[model samples]
Target: GRLVEWGGTRQIIKEPRQEYTNALVSVHEIEHQEQKPGTTPFLSVKNITAAYGRSHVKVLKNVSVDIYPGQTLAVVGESGSGKSTLARAITGLLPPEEGTVTFDGRPLANRLADRPKEDLRQLQMIYQMADVAMNPRQTVGTIIGRPLEFYFGLRGRQRDARVAELLDKIEMGKGFIDRYPAELSGGQKQRVCIARSLAAKPKLIICDEVTSALDPLVANGILKLLLELQKEENVAYLFITHDLATVKSIADSIAVMYRGEVVRYGAKSQVLAPPFDAYTDLLLSSVPEMEIGWLEKAIKGRRMASAGN
Candidate 1:
């Protein structure tokens, strides 16, 4: 077999140090980013497997991650990567075909409806589409107040007062309490969803691509609001998204998933460091930059690297 050594260019030295047939890239570079440090594990999803339909097509394969109190665990991956499946499994909404979800110190029921009211109240999830998530006919006040009533039994003036408080926390005007979902802007509608989730006083909130639907500026503001609320409530977040920049901004621990498997998992610093896995490298290299000739430069870099091999 012909042998080759890879570098900036092919070096066809007949007298090589060792008999090598060919050089293949064994891995790719992938990176994660985060701030803050992990605390004791408040929520943990142990080895879990999930499937689609009854075809037994497994979409999630033995995936596990921990959400520590006062920290954010961001799950980053591309579309159809099973990020949302993992979220549902942990929340007991989709029920993992095999595995246990432990919260605080107790194991949660496999099905959400089977879980206790206390469990349901404490585990809140914000969906990507705020329009369909909230009832169109319900005013913002009723939407936010319902959680307070259902979870804490706050009634009459007490519930209304708490609703106003939550609206303030989400940076929505007090007047927004009376408006329906149709009356609010895209960002405002998402803010209502945030307010609703917070009204439950959940210890861990699963944010399922919460910002992907908003304008860039609005998304930034929403993220800032979440961070500020975290400081005030000491809540934990299981953030699911395909956005790397968001991962860099909010994650305490990052789990990079590919085709339903977690290829890389660690704190931001360790994961983002060099020697990235093959899939990770591809994903990282694919991030779009806002500059002239950026695409051409990236293509050139890849071509140059490929030429060496």
Candidate 2:
């Protein structure tokens, strides 16, 4: 309910003054070295404005961000903040009423259907729900191989071979190749979804809340695997999530969204550093700390801020 102390994970875990924080001795922060933005961006969304239906309500207001090759840009926001809408705009699922999307230095078509096959091949999406994302009736091999066959025309033994290789990459050995999605665990299912996207050999992947569904341990493993895959494949990621912990784990850069607008955007170190914007500060303060009386402190802080306003 409140944060008693904030410091390096090892320091807090080994020397917890608060009894509540003592229970978290076993927890460890994910090891990540935040990187600065590179000179060139692989995907650029410039001054985008989008709306839905006839309401004329702009879901995204002049949103813009740059994603570099082989890096992760984690978009953090509460629900209804337009983070996912930004993804939709980049993916061309919801064409932006204003602004342009440029990928690999080429301007992208406004609609997904209008994009060239090469454009389609280089951009992929891994959704949040692995269960619904895969066909219940399809075998694991078939599920993964469909993209290989569709994009590369691999067939028969060749497709099977590639599917097995992908399975190995996801750290699921070849034995699970013939099993159905119903038989796999949640993490395994998401790993399969990752393999499916990897099969496309994409330059950029839009991961929409990909880990929010799993247990903490399982989600940590997924994050580690994604980082490993990113290293080996040189693929950029647009990682959207509301979890600050997850953002700290995987992001090289970040964009903090609020009410259809980007309130903060920068390298991870810059965005997560001190002197936070009001919304970002509130979001950080709202994360439940392991320290005793954290909730009370948070409540009091909010009340004081409310009074000031």
Candidate 3:
């Protein structure tokens, strides 16, 4: 067992109760267009209420949030909490029964076909399973190059050069362009997916649990790559996931979803800090730490709370 001492544990738990410190954390002014006095949101989902049916199954209930350019608004929740449904609704795969989604000051049609060609080209999605998203018959070149052809009409030498360039951006150089999905590693496949989305020169990308399937190291790489790409491209992301740790790692802002509602929404530092909502407190406590006696202490604390209740 590694005997590690958290020097601040006792101090933080004791929490000196200093009004000045509390006020400082509470009033930390986050800079953004949304925070600015008069600037409008880059992307706005206003009162989005979505349902699935033949039978009318309600998945999202009047959910709303704003996303800024070159930032991530991570939607985090447990399964069946309607995380994926939100993504589908935004992309117009599942039309919201009520409310509207606006991007760049213009309203988008809730159905894919009803939306303009520019809207389709500018909004992209990366699924959780990269293997399933990729076609086995198509080589990496075809998969990544096709989007460039469709969106920009680049062909032959131009297309191949662009494809190789994209491959390089994803950390897979020109040599790997000739390889098929089956020949690539899990991380490589995910990188190709990123390149494919980038090929569209998208304004926004709906990343639906893009890292959950990868190993910890691989996932970290993907997250780093995405952040680097975002800084270079100035693209926004509506990143969906269940992991709060993942949110803390990469999200600029966070929207915590519970039972089809956003219980908490704010900047990453503020949301992860103290004075969390009840469900949020529980959610935060659930994240495991690499330390001794954590589970036992948590169990005892929960037992005491339950007994008090």
Winning model by lDDT: 2
Q: After best superposition, candidate 2 residue 204: deviation in angstroms?
A: 0.5
Per-residue lDDT over 263-286 for candidate 2, one digit per residue giving the tens place of the 0 to 100 score? 999999899999999999988888
Candidate 3: Cα lDDT at 92: 94
| TM-score of predicted structure 3 | 0.87
Candidate 3's residue-wise lDDT over 130-197, tens digit each?
99999999999999998898988999999999999998898889999889899998999999999999
**Would you list the clashing residue pairs of candidate 1?**
27-278, 28-276, 28-277, 28-278, 29-280, 29-281, 30-280
Ranking 1 against 2 by lDDT, winner: 2
Angstrom error at residue 253, model 2: 0.8
lDDT, model 1: 0.83
What's the distance in Å from true for residue 128, model 1? 0.6
Runs with alpha carbons beyond 4 Å of true place in candidate 2? 1-28
Expressed as tens digits, the lDDT of each residue in 34-139 for candidate 1 is 5556555899888899887879799999988888888888899899999999988887777888878899989999898899999998999999999999999999
| TM-scores for candidates 1 onward, in order | 0.86, 0.91, 0.87
- Per-residue lDDT for 201 in model 3? 95
